[model samples]
Target: MTTLRIILGDQLSTTISSLHDIDKHNDLILMCEVNEEAQYVKHHKKKIAFIFSAMRHFAEGLKKKKYNLLYTKLTDKENTGSFKGEVKKTIRQHHINHIIITHPGEHRVLEDIQSWETDLNVSLEIREDNRFICSTDEFTKWVKNRKQPRMEHFYRHMRKQKTVLMDDDKPIGGKWNYDTDNRKPPKSNLTIPKPCSQKPDQITKEVISLVNEKFKDHLGELDGFDLAITRDQALKALENFLSKRMPSFGDYQDAMLEGEPWMYHSHISTYLNAGLLLPMECVKAAEDAYLNGSAPMNAAEGFIRQILGWREYIRGIYWLKMPGYADMNFFNATRPLPSFYWTAKTDMNCLKQSISETKKNAYAHHIQRLMILGNFALLTGIDPKQVSEWFLIVYTDAYEWVELPNVYGMALFADGGYLASKPYAAGGSYINKMSNYCKNCEYNVKKKTGADACPFNYLYWNFLAKNKKKLEKNHRLAMMYSTYERMDEKTKKQIKNDSLQFLENLT
Candidate 1:
């Protein structure tokens, strides 16, 4: 029987499960650039271009190997505009009766794929996506009977299981985590190295043109389109990070600068998520750097933990709690995300800088996402759906499996204490301590209230006071509530009035 294998754009690796049992003679690979996927969220223009270019590049690589392949361009006359439509068309044209697919990253896509068997009357075999170190079933098994499924515990499990950063069966540097050594804020004299980048080859140039013509209204520009689009380029990017940046990656992993966006970061997450680089390969590379005495243990362990631990754990949480999880609003937040998110017109320097960088690069480091933008959303009470959509639309690396939990659970705490023990909400002082953004702002970070005060200050307290009934019981926040209770009645009233007035003025 002839088989039609469906490879989604994100599944660009040759090691993808669907391609493992290849029959060059009888199996035909079908890859489509559909409008439905691209237009799902007004995705960043660079993101669309990168994915399309990488898909085209991967298809070319397969063709060089003499595979039976059907590649669909977005402007193909016979293009069906949707994955299922394309699959049906391919089945009729090729007389294919069987379909093989790898499980998709998004739950919504999986539901549609699950329907294809009955809806199209075809034989469907969906294989497990083995690209990740931890399988969905493995994560489920790990969670069985566990009270709180946090990343820290799961990370340690992965470290030992994977034998990563292990010294005689023990974690290197005497601890499973080195976060205490890694939190030095960005200093004034810091010299940030830019990640390795390449000029767009002919294929990428064409893809950029296509994006310009088709998605001109998308969020980000094609200017400075320097991300790696192929596996070879992505490997170079990984090596470059280890040689030049990994040593300092942990120290400033959470730090932010006014104009500096790529401070000691690998910047390969886009490549990692797009399947150009395998997660294990990146993890091993960081581990090798530490053993070779190039990157310190704190840097290597921290970096490895992000890939092997947090990345896997987050994906686990996503699969474990999705479909119903997206609808959670633990804070019952209902405010519309203000227009300043799109325009970067806010007086707060941190928000303005984070949004402006997001508009330019379709990327922001974790702290900017968590403390600045996500923190503001949490503090000011933006609806989770709106915040989630904005994040999904903007980042080049944001697929729903990873992006959803990070934004919904880690960023907004919309899942409440289920995913995070405490809200990541913070005031201007935290930003002031961690970043130089507060230094250049119009509002004073030190001020507690008034017109010239940072909005985060009151918004932070307001979010706490407003959600006290739900959050005060949390052990992590006991001290915070005690501090709030210590304030005199007049001070509390002023805080209430300032918060109301500031939030009311938001548009």
Candidate 2:
């Protein structure tokens, strides 16, 4: 009985679970570049190129191992556009009676895979993706009968379970989080370490050319496609980050610079999400940096929390609450996302820098994503689904499992309070504090109303005032409501009028 083993683009790791017990002679490994997956969201040109190139590189490695592999390039004449169609054709051609695949990362793909058994009339075995530290079953058990699934509580549990940053039974440095120390704003003269970039190999160059020709009208540019497409390059990137950038990573983890897109941030998310670098390896690298005194305890601890804590927590939350989670619109935010999000044609320097960087590189640090683009979307009341889709389309590192929780829950607060305790709504002042974009902005940061004032300043108050009944009861936002109530009627009226006028002219 021949078995067909399917591998998705994100499952590029040779150590992936589905490949564990493969029979080299009888089993055929199937990897395809399906249009259904690539064009599902009009993904960034760079993103498409990266995934395709990485998959091609990985397939070549499998070929060297003498495995029976059925690889379909996108431009191939007989290529089917969907995974199910391709699998059906492959099964019939190879006379296969059994199929095995790792569970897909996104809920949509998982739902589609669930129907494959009946459609193909074969014994389909969907194996668990064991790359993550916490399994879906484990996450579900942790959240069972819980009123609120707080990330910090989950993070603490993971710390104990994994012994990450642990000294015997307690956390090192006498603290679980170094977030307070990690929020220092960028200084104008700070020397930032640049992230390592890999020049494209022959395979990657061909993939880039293909993406340019096919996805010519896609969101981002492919001029400087320097991402690491192979496992060795990914390991080099991780080494560069730990040795050179980890020292200052925590100090300016939340800081942003106008033209500096990387700013001490590890650019390994693309590699990690693509399965080039395993999560445990990254966690251990940071811990090793701390133990060897190559990096500060705060820096190492903060970096570890992101991968071991926030990254894993978000994934667990995603798997635990999908299908219905994407439909959530807790605040009923219905305003359409503005054109500036696409065109980057705005006077707001922060938005311009962040969006432009995304369009050019398909990358932006977490702060730029959360505080700049996400904050604007939240304050302006853009539809959570629209914003979430925009995020999924534009970022190279975006996949629905990671992107949805971040946008729908943390960014827009669309899940009400499931992922985050408070809405991350903020004004221009917060941007000014964290970034240098305000120095070149057209609007005055000090002004709170009228033309020439930062739009965020007035819109922030407008959002609170408009959503008062819905948000005022939250203890986290009680202080802001009290402050708003103390404001004179004339000031409140000016804020409302200016905000409405600004929003009216947004398009």
lDDT of 2 by residue, 1-507 (tens): 689999999999999999999999889999999999999999999999999999999999999999999999999999989998899899899998998999899999998888888977898999999899989898999999989888888888999899999988899989998889998999999887777988998999899899989989899888878999998999999999999999999999999998899999889999999999899999999999999999998899889888888899899989888889999998898889999899999999999999999999999999989988998888888899999999999998999999999999899899999899999999989999999899999999989987899999989999999999889999999999999999999999999999888878874
Compute each candidate's TM-score over C-alphas: 0.99, 0.99
- Misplaced by over 4 Å in model 2 are none
- For residues 1-507, what per-residue lDDT tens digits would candidate 1 score against the true structure? 589998999999999999987899989999999999999889999899999999999999999999999999999999999999999999898988999999999999999999999999999999988889999999999999988898899999999899998877788889999998888888999988877988999999999999999999888899889988889999999999999999999899889988998899898888988889999999999998999999998899889989999899999999999899999998888999999999899888898999999999999998999999999999988999999999999999999999999999999889877778899999999999899998889998899988888888888888899999999989999999999999988878878899999889885
Worst 10 residues of 1 by lDDT: 412-421
What's the distance in Å from true for residue 437, model 1? 0.7
Clashing pairs in 1: none
Candidate 2, clashing residue pairs?
Answer: none
lDDT of each: 0.91, 0.92
N/CA/C clash count, model 2: 0
